[model samples]
Target chain A: MQEELIRKHRWFWAWADDREEAWLREMAQQGLHLGKAAPLGEYFFVRGEPRDDVYRLDYVPMSKKDEHYYQLFKDAGWEHVGEMMGWQYWRKLATDSQADEIFTDNDSKIQKYQRLLAILTIFLPVLIINVTNMGVFSLREKYPWIIGLQVFSIFLLVFYSVVLLRILFRIRMLRRR
Target chain B: MAGSDVRKYLPLTESTYYILVALSEPMHGYGVMQKVEKLSEGTVTIGPGTLYGAFGTLEKAGLIRMVKEEERRKSYLLTARGRAVLKEQITRLAIMNRNGQGLLGILD
Candidate 1:
């Protein structure tokens, strides 16, 4: 029964399988290189008792291809299961009520806070510079060195902002790791 | 460790050594961790981050490559260069063992 199932499955291509071997030979005979974009074969996952069976047919398209076999599966009435990164799996849900639950981690408060801080770091110094310059104009009436001091403050703020941004960017990259 | 002993592994870090040792077979990250722990008798414990970092470095250096990847796991295999490095490390360890035992002069 297992041998018959494997023989019937389209994904179970073997060198000894005359049909697949002939197909490969025909393609080669056409002077077309069997590039990495062809379907390698397919397989199914069936476990547990015969009465209560679960079937998951898996297909590997070429060495690193998927679109072709995916269309093939779709045409055969197989439902698409969620992919694991680039590796995809398809399953026909046994019943209407049965659904596979895939886990995904949502962004936490700490991550959100870090992102917010990163954005704030970008504009914080510009806001500081604007406020300090405004103060310089307003206080110039009473203080003679107000403009000079404000210019120095602007430079300091710019330097601080650059340093802060660098540090924040580094932290963000580290957090991503 | 002595300077000469440390200098033998110019590129491979301690973690890389542990990883290569673990990959003597095609083992996944968690399996590698378990093997390293067992081999060291619980002296070294590599966290996921550190182990991945070392793995990335070893892979980039062409000392290891992915053998297989299953659900939530990836197994690695050592390259020819990796095997050579492992051999050299073992030889160094053998020398160190002999030297220490010779110094002790204790009868087995």
Candidate 2:
């Protein structure tokens, strides 16, 4: 599954699975229009005209009231300005206070930290295993101690991956909230 | 509680004020959006995401509640608290307007 996703896109949004794809399809069905096709989570960003600003709405769906707010903003002369995956929206503020609201309380930084952990979880174990494999080949005998350490490291890595996956799921749920 | 009044609740955002004003009618999400835009003279365009975020907050605050739902769409109405807030805002605006006009000698 991962291989297929990597083939289609240079980067995977996170992971690929049939269920994930189905849910993404449902999100698209709700109100989103994808500019380009890739994989379940992989999205291609595109820039459009000044009138119709392009945005790739991720799995996150905007609420009904926020939709009203955006319309009000658009009515107030805030044109389609820019787009980002689910986070960025073109807004023109009537008041300085309104503009202040945009910069405050962004969770993206924390999300990025979590993503860093995910990358470590994915790569760290692989590194340990490759190093152990090389050592075993050079030694010409699988030392019992080294074998036990390698097995333990692999198990730890698998456990770390599961925990990272859980954290990612929690973040997704928070986005829904 | 249902009639015209201006007190008890206060400190409403412009978006919330407009939303409550629009919800005075039986308007759905798109309907409320349209009315707000029309009333504001096309000065505000609330995206769908932001609308839902506000709805979640307002509904949780007991200022608004979901009145109807159809398929994936929903309509919300102001609660008594929401109406009170709107009334208070109106009274405050009125007072400020009167004082400013008197001070500026703009009233006839």
Candidate 3:
């Protein structure tokens, strides 16, 4: 029997949304269409006829009136496939007359990154507090395991910094053009 | 609109200008998007993301208000302040257009 569904695992950072969109489009062309998305980089696909559909990802904070948001997109010809952690996955059949974008103006496009940046920065205070209270430098002599914990903390801090910088860079690039 | 208020929204961007003009009648976000395209003669297209965000901003600024809600769709109309702002914008555009009327040959 042919498999009707397949699960693919992939990870994409917040700044690499375009790369993720391209990958989804490629999967569609290969007779696999995204049917569901799960957290921690899990995507389930359904086998289907080959298509040249375009996929777009938009990030929006959870709102009280999300139904209106969905309806607007539906009317605008975008099919809201799935949403994960405020990231909306939209798909539409490719048409020659229309551009593959859900944001027509630069300000709204920049606002998308600004929203992502806000979510990422909310962790800044918590990260700072955890590092300061750890006092791992002085405790390293008393407990060797604290060194490993401290290293992990530094690694997380570095990862957060890079993500923040990339999002800011994207905003600046959008503003310049 | 007051002098200060008019100045704040005078130089509307292309999308914002078209959106405000479209809100002259009560219409939902998608309706506004379609009307904008038609009014601009296919020159401008407002994607759903942009239109959704604009609705929030315009509503917050008191330039547009929800007049009715049908199912999940909310229709909005221009507030008095929004109409005033649009008027000011059109006047500004007319002046600018007149100033550049006979200067096309200056461009390379």
Task: Name the top lDDT candidate.
Answer: 3
What is the Å distance of residue A24 in model 1 from its true position?
61
lDDT of 3 at A23: 96
What does the lDDT come to for candidate 1? 0.51
- DockQ of all candidates, in order? 0.01, 0.08, 0.81
What is the lDDT of every predicted structure here? Answer: 0.51, 0.52, 0.88
- The sequence of per-residue lDDT tens digits that candidate 3 reaches over residues B14-41 is 9999999999999998889889999999
| Per-model TM values vs. the true structure | 0.39, 0.45, 0.93
Q: Considering TM-score, which of the candidate structures 1 and 2 is the better prediction for this target?
A: 2
Residues A1-177, candidate 3: write the lDDT tens digits: 876769999998888899999999999999899998888889999998999888999998786337899999998889989988888999998774555679889999899898888888999888877776676563747565676677778788888888899999989999999
Scored against the true structure, residue A6 in model 3 reaches a CA lDDT of: 92
TM-score of candidate 2 relative to the true fold? 0.45
Tell me which of candidates 1 and 2 scores higher on DockQ.
2
Give the residue spans of candidate 3 off by over 4 A: A1-3, A63-65, A96-99, A136-141, B105-108
The DockQ-derived docking category for candidate 3 is high
Clashing pairs in 3: none
Better of 1 and 3 by DockQ: 3
lDDT of 1 by residue, B43-72 (tens): 665543345445556787777888887664
Better of 1 and 2 by lDDT: 2
